[model samples]
Target chain A: MRIGELAERAGTTTRTLRYYESRGLLPARRAENGYRTYDEGDLRLIQQIRTLQDFGFDLEETRPFVDCLRAGHPAGDSCPASLAVYRRKLGELDALIGQLQSVRTEVGAQLARAELEASAELPGGPEPRCELGPTAPQSPVGPNWEDER
Target chain B: MRIGELAERAGTTTRTLRYYESRGLLPARRAENGYRTYDEGDLRLIQQIRTLQDFGFDLEETRPFVDCLRAGHPAGDSCPASLAVYRRKLGELDALIGQLQSVRTEVGAQLARAELEASAELPGGPEPRCELGPTAPQSPVGPNWEDER
Candidate 1:
């Protein structure tokens, strides 16, 4: 199929398809007229790429797996290098999850603080509080030290 | 203190401080020689800006909150609009976390599958399990079900 057709079928833009091609994830044959021709394998590879990207693997990191697949290696028995790549990706994902969890905790605490301050009447009057503005003191230096070792 | 001093104390580059000034996040007074002068409050504001950025808030989104603080309004109070912004940001973070979690699960599954296949050592020589090459099997219809879905 043509580049446009492949892009339409793949649910991505032609630009993205070209980018994947440039990244060595997708290979296409150039026609006499210079049009790029892609086949079913290209489609499957694109699907795998999209699925992995949805699952958070950056394009650069997904290349080895794509290459292994293209080389006719079985899914689970592909290149040992691919296995190493997967391990590295797993580690990165773990780190990302830890960071996100920390951020979630901080945001939750901030939300609770906002709600608490919102419930109290401001000193001036019944006007809605502007706790997010300048006058509010910085969050207490640290959470209560009771849990500290 | 001057911009250089503030930048040094804040652990940021002078270029970044200048960028913040250009972006209206930091306000500074111009001296006779065109040098920028910063006060203690400005330092505090810079610190707060850094903190907010660390918390994943973009400079544009932090602008109103910074402005309220600069104007001496109560900082912690919930401005409905700012709260709305916070909610939007939280939603984005949640979506990101969900995506990362999904990716983690998929990667884990792939790793398990790879390990299992590696251990099995099937009697038959390896054949390409999935059509990942250009000439691989073509779907009768358009793209694969995963892509269409």
Candidate 2:
């Protein structure tokens, strides 16, 4: 198949396929007219790359899996190199999640503190409403505390 | 105060202050000697911008808080516009955390599946190690599934 046909089959773009080729993840043979040609094996490698890409692997990170597939492995992760990449990515994702969770906690605290200060300045009837418990003043507007963008 | 003093007081760099000025976030006044001049209020605004930056806010997203502080509010989130930015950021953070969590879940599942597949390929004597149970078949040599590469 041609580049366009393979890209169509992979549900990716020709540009992405070209990028993968540039990175040597997917090498192709040339037709007589200088067009990129692919076979079922090539398609298999591209599919392996695409599956890893969908799992958030960078192009460089997918190289090991591509190499494994090119080495005739039954699956991409059938090799140790690919498994190492998966392990590295898992650690990075875990650290990223921890950082984001910490940021969420801090940002939530700041939002609560700012809201409390804002409400305290209002013309409440001085019921000792500051630095104390809240009776849930002013029905919430805009996005709620648990809302997502 | 001079640019150096301002940067030092804010625990940042003159390059960063200049970048912020170029982005029109923290414009500085020109001294008679052709140097940049700053005041305490400018310092306050820079601090506000820094706080938001620390909270993972983009420079553009910190504009509302800067504007609020410039409008003489007690704090950055003291204004409705700043509060709206907070709400928007909260929504964005929530969405981002949600996406990362989903990715984490999928990556974790992939890791587990790949580990199981890798372990199953060992030279065990085929003692019902098909897909059901694993009674410590082979001694681990390469990266364990529990190991973070």
Candidate 3:
């Protein structure tokens, strides 16, 4: 198949396929007419690259799996090198999740504090509140009764 | 102070300060000598921008807080606009963290499955295993008794 057909079948752009070729990832064979040609095996390779990219893998990080596929492994992760990349990516994801969680907590706390301060500065100070204990049922008029009136 | 001094105090490069100026986020005053000048207020604005950036805010997202500071608010988040930005950012962070967590779980599961498959393909098949229940006391030789020999 031609480069265009392979890219279409793989659900990617020809530019991306050319980029993979430039990276020496998916080298295409030259046909007698001097056009780039690809086989179904190359299509499988592209699919593998796309999957890892969707998982936030860097283009470079996909190299090991691509190499594994090219080496005729049953699957990309069938190679030790590919498995090692998976382990490394897992560690990276854990670190990123930890950092984001910390940031989320800090941002949440800051927003709460700022909101409290803003409410306190209102004409009547902080608004009145109710814990809504089990015995104290909600008002029959509903929570937005004032709006309805 | 000159642009260089402002950049140094803000712990940022002059190029970045210029970039912010281009974005109209930080406009500097023109000194009598035709050099770009900044004052303590500009320093505060730069600090506010830096803080939001460290919290993973995009350059555009920092605009609201910068505007609040420029409007003479006590803090960057004192204004309603800044508060709105905070709320939106909280939502965004929550979404991003959730996605990362899902990806983490998927990658972890993939790694475990791959590891199991790899081990099963070894000459002796999968390694023998022990759950190490509480009832089974630890061997004095430690977990690596074979290695100890």
Candidate 4:
């Protein structure tokens, strides 16, 4: 298959395929007419690359899986290298999710505090003399962000 | 204060401050000696920008807050414009958190499935059950990712 046909079959763009080729992750054979040609092996390698790419794997990280497939493994992740990539990816995802969860909490707290302060300035506002104290923290970012204040 | 002094006060880098200035987000006045000078109001604006930046807000998103502070408001987020930005940011954060949670679930499921399959292939693995059938989904990514396969 040609680049266009391969891209169409793989549900990806030619630009992406070209990028993969440039990264040497997916090399193409040159035909008699000076055009790129691909075999069933290339298609399988592409499938391996696309699968891990969708799983949030970097191009470099997908190399192990592609290599495993080219090595005639039953599945892209059938090799130890591929399994190690999966383990590393799991750790990265866990850390990222934790960080994002913390950011969400902090942002939510800041929003609540700002909204409260805004409402307190309106006429006939509720009595809030006890909650807001002189020595209390002013910024809605909370005390943990000592560098910000 | 000079750019370096302002960056030191804001707990940021002079390079970052200059980048902000380049983006026209934090403009500085030129002294008689062709040096950049900033006052207390500028310091407040930088602090506001840095606080929001630490909260994962983009430099452009911090504009309204900086404008509010430049207009002599008590805080960057004390104005209606800044409030609107806050509301929009909250929505974005909520959507992002939801997406991350979904990805986490998907990745956890993948990890568990891979681990189970790996253990199941070990020597003297669990009883040979009839449950391993063709109808079982192969990957946790679901059947929708058939394009990759």
Selected candidate, larger lDDT, 1 vs 3: 3
User: Could you give candidate 2's per-residue lDDT for residues A54-95 as a string of tens digits?
Assistant: 767878888777767776777777767777787788888888
DockQ of all predictions against the true structure, Cα-based: 0.21, 0.20, 0.17, 0.15
* Residue-wise C-alpha lDDT for candidate 3, range B1-149, written one tens digit per residue: 99999999999999999888877688877988899988999999999998889899999888777867776767888766677778888999899989988888888888899778877877585644322322333345533213212
Ranking by TM-score: 3, 2, 4, 1
Looking at model 2, residue B28 earns an lDDT score of: 69
TM-score of each: 0.76, 0.79, 0.81, 0.77
Q: State which candidate has the highest DockQ.
A: 1
How accurate locally is residue B139 in candidate 2, as Cα lDDT from 0 to 100?
32
Better of 3 and 4 by TM-score: 3
Give per-candidate clash totals.
14, 0, 0, 0
**Which 10-residue window in model 3 chain A sums to the lowest lDDT?**
A129-138
Which is better, 2 or 3, measured by TM-score? 3
- Which is superior by lDDT, 1 or 2? 2
Off by over 4 Å in 4: A124-149, B122-149
Residues A120-140, candidate 4: write the lDDT tens digits.
875575642222222333446
Best by lDDT: 3
> In model 3, which residue pairs have backbone atoms overlapping below 3 Å?
none
